[model samples]
Target: MSIPAFADISKSANDLLNKDFYHLSAGTIEVKSNTPNNVAFKVTGKSSHEKATSGAIEGKYADKSLGIKGRVYLLLPTCHPKKGVKLNLTFKQSAFHGRAFFDLLKGPTANVDAVIGHEGFLAGASAGYDVQKAAVTGYSAAVGYIAPQYSAAITATDNLSVFAASYHKVNSQVEAGAKATWNSKSGSAVGLEVASKYRLDPVSFAKAKINDRGVAAVSYNVLLRPGVTLGLGASFDTQKLEQATHKVGASFTFES
Candidate 1:
C-alpha cells in the first residue's frame, strides 16, 4: 500500500463524514470534462439562501512521464482585483511528492508541502509563509503507517498546540474509522468522532457517524448512471431534538 500525505492521514473517515453532505439551504451544480491530451476542465456554480450566487472555473493538466500536474482556478466575482486567481502545482514520484500553492486572494499567500513514503510508512511536513509580514505563519509534522487493511497516523499541528490521531480499517462489506484530537493550549476535554460506511451493493452505499458532541449524521449515495450520481444526507442535534434543529441535503453530480 502507498502511504498518504500528512493531511490525508484521516481522509477515509473525513470523507465519509464530510463529502456529499450538501447544505439543504444551498444548491450546487458541477460539470467536469477530460480531454485525451491529459487536460481537464471543471465548472461549478453554487447558490444559497444566506449568500449570493457564485461560481468558479478550473483547468488542469498533467504530464504522466514527468510526474507533474498543474491547476488554476478563477473565482467568480473576482474576490480581489489584484489577486483573483489561484494556482497549484505538484510533482510526484514513487517515494516522494511535493506541492506548492498560491492563493493571492487571501494575504497574497503561498505555501508548500512535501511527503516521503517507503514500505507503507510515511512522514511529511508543511509550512506556510506570509509574504507581507515576511514571517513563517505556521508549520506541522506527521507520521503514519499504512497497510492493506488498516492505517494509523498521528500529527501535531497549530504550532504544536494541537495533537490528533486517527485510525481506519476495512472489512468485507464495511469500513470503519475514528479520530481524536486535543488542544494543549485550551486545556479542554478531548474531541472524538467515529464513522462507518456499509456497502449495500456494488452501486450503492450508506454511511453514518457521530461525534463527542451530541450531533449525528447519515448519508446515502447511489450511482444513477455511468456518469451520474445522487446523494442524500441528514444531520441532527441529538441534544436538542425537540428544537427541530435538523438539516437535510441532496446533491447530484455529472462527469464525462
Candidate 2:
C-alpha cells in the first residue's frame, strides 16, 4: 500500500464518518449495513460542481476468535481519467496494522505501511521510492503519545516537511491544540495554527481556529437524531477583512 501524499476521507468509512461537514459543499448519500455473518459495509456517493460525481464501497470483516480484522475499499470517479479508479486494503491485529495500497492515474505507484502501538503510544512509517511516479514520492514517519489530559506527536517526510502538534484537554468543556510545520525544501515556514473546541452539551460542540495566515474560522455541530448530524461553518480572511466562506451539511447513518 502506498501512503497518500494527503488524506482522502472518501476512501474509508472511518474517515468519512469523522468528517465535519461544516465546510462541505457537496451533496452526499451514504448507507451502512452489516451482513448476517457480521461483515460490515458502507456505500457512499457524492456530487458537486467541483468534484462531479464519485462513490466508494468499503467493507470490514473481523474475526474476534482469530484476533484479526481486514478492510478494503474501491473508489470510482465519474470524471477525470487520472482519478477514475483507486483501491486499498488494510489488515490489523493486536499491536500491528498493515496496508497495501495504490492508485492508477499515475505510473504504477504502490505503498505499504505498518504501525506498532498500544493504548498510549504509537509509531508508523511509509515509503515510496520512485520520484517520477508521483510528486509525493518520498518517505514519512510519525510517533506520538496520548494521555487523558494531553497528547503530542512529531512527523517528518522526505519531501522536507517536518511538523509537530500537541493538544490538551483543559477541562470537560474545553480542549486546545496547535500545530506548526516547516518545509526545508521550500526554504520557508508553514503557518502555525491554534485550535480549540468547546462542548456545549452532551450532543453539541463548537470549534474555532486562528492561523499565521491571518485566517480565522469557526464551526458548530449538533446531533439532530440518533443517526443524523448537522454542521455549520464560516471563515474570515483578516487580510481582506471579509468573509471567506460559509457552508452547512448533514449526514445520516443506518446499520443493522
Q: Write the per-residue lDDT of candidate 1 for residues 1-256, one digit (tens) a residue.
A: 5546557865765676566666453567778899999999998887764667888999999997977777777889675664356777767688887878887777778888888999988889999988888888999888888788888888889887898888889987999888899999998899998888899999999988889997898888899999888877788899999996887766777899
Scored by lDDT, model 1 comes in at 0.81
TM value for model 2: 0.68
List the candidate 2 regions with Cα displacement exceeding 4 Å: 1-21, 49-51, 79-110, 114-124, 129-137, 168-171, 241-256
Point to the candidate with the largest lDDT. 1
Q: Judge candidate 1 at residue 105 and give its lDDT.
A: 73
Model 1: runs farther than 4 Å from truth?
A: 1-3, 49-52, 66-68, 82-93, 100-110, 131-134
Task: Point to the candidate with the largest TM-score.
Answer: 1
- Which run of 10 residues does model 1 get worst, by summed lDDT? 17-26
